[model samples]
Target: MTMTVVPAPAETGHSVAPPGRNRRVRQHWGATPYLFLLPALTLLGVFFVWPAVTAVQLAFYDYRVVSPAEFVGLGNFSHMLGDDRFYTALTNSGLFLIGMLPILVVIPLLLAVLVNLPLRGIKVFRLVYYLPVVTSMVAVAIAWNYVYHQRGILNWLLNTLGLLDQPVQYLLDPGWALPALVLVESWKSLGYYMMIYLAGLQSVPRELYEAAAVDGAGPWRRLSSITVPMLRPYIAVVMVLAALDSMQVFTSVFVMTQGGPQDGTLTLGYYIYDAAFRHFNMGYASAMGLVLWAILVVFSLVSYRLTRGKAAAR
Candidate 1:
């Protein structure tokens, strides 16, 4: 007997999805993240983007808060070339960068290595080191003011050690003002850089140290060969950060010296503030700000290239 054969349903060129599948996919994959990000994006635009654009526009226009903005094109920037104080501020900023680099970049690594040792109550030491980083800068500056005072503990210790003939006014002396501020800034931020190095150290393999030790490598040799090379990226990051901090040093200068003692501590940041607020030369200040920003950008680019090239060579 011949069985009656039924043809199965033919497949279509386009397949139909389930009724709610597309809706579910769309709901799960889209819009939610953007919706959650809306607040942050709005805040950033309002606070950062808007202010940056205003600053750039104001760089070309003379605005003294009381007077109408007068467009002068590159006049503000041109004026900077003839301004002696601008050059002085630039020079001081460079000094800060030079002084802070070793303090933040090199010394912090050693500090991190010291704190990273598996010793009892080491966390307490780490916490103490990081305390200044978390403390308010204003408070730190006030505390440092006492430390730098003519009759303060620092001077007393120096006198006791016969390092000085008499107490010196650190903040009031032109020769010492910038260096004093640099030390304060460096000390306050040392903990931060230390934490960064500590984090980098955590990822390094203990086996490398073991192997190096097995090969008769001493601590300094291992540090120079393994730790330094491994921490290159961290060093690059710290360098860029420290450079930026040094270049834009304002609060310490303002609080401690007020750019006094013959303007020895007049950093670019403080100069911008002085021009804008004290002298009411907002346009010139904005121009200087732009120049400072350009300098920082250049420094970052150079640092990145050097670090990346070294990394690639290795």
Candidate 2:
């Protein structure tokens, strides 16, 4: 017996939909993921967006905790122009950025190179270098306080080496206070930047170094030509991060000098804190905060552009 196969009836110029089409459509445009994201979005708006709006609004008003807010409309910003302390803070913050750049950007690269060596137990060295990053800033300040003491080991060594006529109080000296805090901040953060560079270093091709070596390139030559070029992106990241950290140096200053020794260690971050909490000038503090934010944003953009332009040129 022969069986004949027949085709099913077809619609006129229209295809029939599969039973699973609606299910697939629902899955493609599902609202479940968005529903899950709503909580985090709500929290972000409450914590970050709300506070940012409040700060901008408060910058236009004079609000001491004891008095009702009076709309001053750029008065706080205008006051910043004539404020000597504001200028001092800005100058000190700039010095910090300068002092920290080498420590964070250059030294860390060397450190990453050292730790990237294939020696036995090299991981131990990396961990040792990174320990300070996880340490509490307050604790580091306290320990550094001992080190900066007149009779401390550092002073003793300095005296032994004839670097100073007598023991000097580092934190209490106007000339040394900012530099001392800079050292503390750099020491604390060096490990973080080193780790960043280490990651970049690891990603670099070993074959490049081998090729350079075959061409009779020395260690320094290979580093300058290969490692540095390859690490440019990481260096850019480090520069921006270091600039931000240096500008906002507050904890060490607060714990060690309290922006004192004749305000030598005064920084934008410290000044903002003092204006907000100590002096209760909330509007002025907010204005200064905005200024600091603007400076950081501009600096970051410029640095990023320069780095990217250099990379592209190469």
Candidate 3:
């Protein structure tokens, strides 16, 4: 007897595709990795993207804590222009960048190069150099505070070295305060940047240096041609990081001087804190915070773009 093949009847509600036709469905189901990424995408949208959009919205309005946001339409931007405090913070921040950038960049690069040499106990030196990077910023700030105080270690050393007529109150003097803070920041930041440069330096091939030496290239020539060019990406990273950190400097200034000595050390970061907590001008403080963020964004973008151009050129 011969058996006949039978086809199943259609579903009551939904229509089922033929077996070969369901390949597209199976292909879609195979896209599980992207589905897994949906959670992270949602998180980024909620945290970073949402907050950024909100910040931009907040920038436009003169918002009050109790009252609804009053749409001021560039009023905050105009107000910031006439704000002497804003100008002061801008100036101080600029000065800080000027003072700290060179030291932070050059010293770290130099240190990295030196430590990367085939010398004895270089690992120990690397560890010693990196200690400050891991050390607590608060503890470092407090330690420096005492050291910078009148009759403290710094003053005592100055006096011992016969460099000062008296124990100068480093934080109290308007002229000295900002520089002092910059020095402290530089000291705290150097180790981290140095480590970064060290990592970058390690990737540089040894053959290049040997070839440079073979060609009668001196130390300066080798550094200028080989070391400097090779480290451009790292330099870019260091500069952008340093710029962002220096631009928003607050904690040390807040704890040490509280933007003291005639507001000499009054930075945008400090001003934002003051307007919010001290003066309770949430709208103005938010405006300033947004402005600070704008500055950071602009600087970072510019630096990144330029770095990309240089990298492309190479």
Candidate 4:
């Protein structure tokens, strides 16, 4: 005699997922992040992308806010060749680019090195240095206005130190106005770039410096051989940022100088603002904006290449 077995029946209320159900669930989860990003993308398109497109279109028109836009093709761009103020603005921007490089790049590196040392109260010093970076540019400009005054703290210190025999007005004088703005801009930006360099410094291996010291390397020698080489990538970043910031110098010129004293401090950014708002030359201003944008693109590309080449060489 033989015994036979029987199969068990399916569960009463349990449902089985259909084929590809797990894949469908995974696809739904993959789309979840894009749903979260939708709000930010919408705002960016509405605010930035739309305005940029409008500006580019306006660059080809002759629109004065009160008048209807007339298609002018490249007329607005051509007009820039005959505009003295345009050239002046370009010159001022060039000066800012030159003036900010050393101050923003070298000084910030030095400050980062100093702050990175294992000294007591170093964190306090770092906080003090970085305070200006978080402060509003408007407030910084207002505060510096006093420092740049004819009889202000800067003049008094210079006088006491015998550096100046008489108080000279900085923002009032056409010759000194642009330079004064450069100083203020550089000062405000230094702390920001310093923190960047500080981050890079902290990432560097401490063993290299220790080994160099064991071999009797001095501070300057160690910095030149080890620290500088290590911080090169950071320097490239700072250089790009500084170049972009310098070319777009505006707030200080607006608040402190108003691009005044015979347009001495008239940077491309300030001029663009003036043409659009003050003079109501929206089309011309938009054209200038496009030109400035092109310049920035080219400048950034060149700078990045140079820095990358140097880093590779080293």
Q: Please name the candidate that would achieve the greatest lDDT relative to the true structure.
A: 4
Clashing pairs in 4: none
**Per-residue alpha-carbon lDDT of model 4 for 1-314, expressed as tens digits?**
99866544454455667769988999999999999999999999999999999999999999999999999999999999999999999998999999999999999999999999999999999999999999999999999999999989999999999999999999999989988999999999889999999999988899999999999999999999998988887888888889999999988989998999999999999999999999999999999999999998987897779777877886
Mind giving the per-residue lDDT tens digits that candidate 3 earns over 5-104? 6655553455777898799789888897889999999999999999778767777887766778888888888898999988999899988888888889
Please rank every candidate by lDDT, starting with the best. Answer: 4, 1, 2, 3
Candidate 1 clashing pairs, residues 3+ apart or interchain: none
Best by TM-score: 4
Q: Residue 80 CA error for candidate 1 (Å)?
A: 0.6
Better of 1 and 2 by lDDT: 1
The TM-score obtained by model 2 is 0.89
| Model 4 spans > 4 angstroms off | 1-9, 12-14, 20-27, 303-314
Per-model TM against the reference = 0.90, 0.89, 0.85, 0.92
Q: Which TM-score value belongs to model 1? A: 0.90
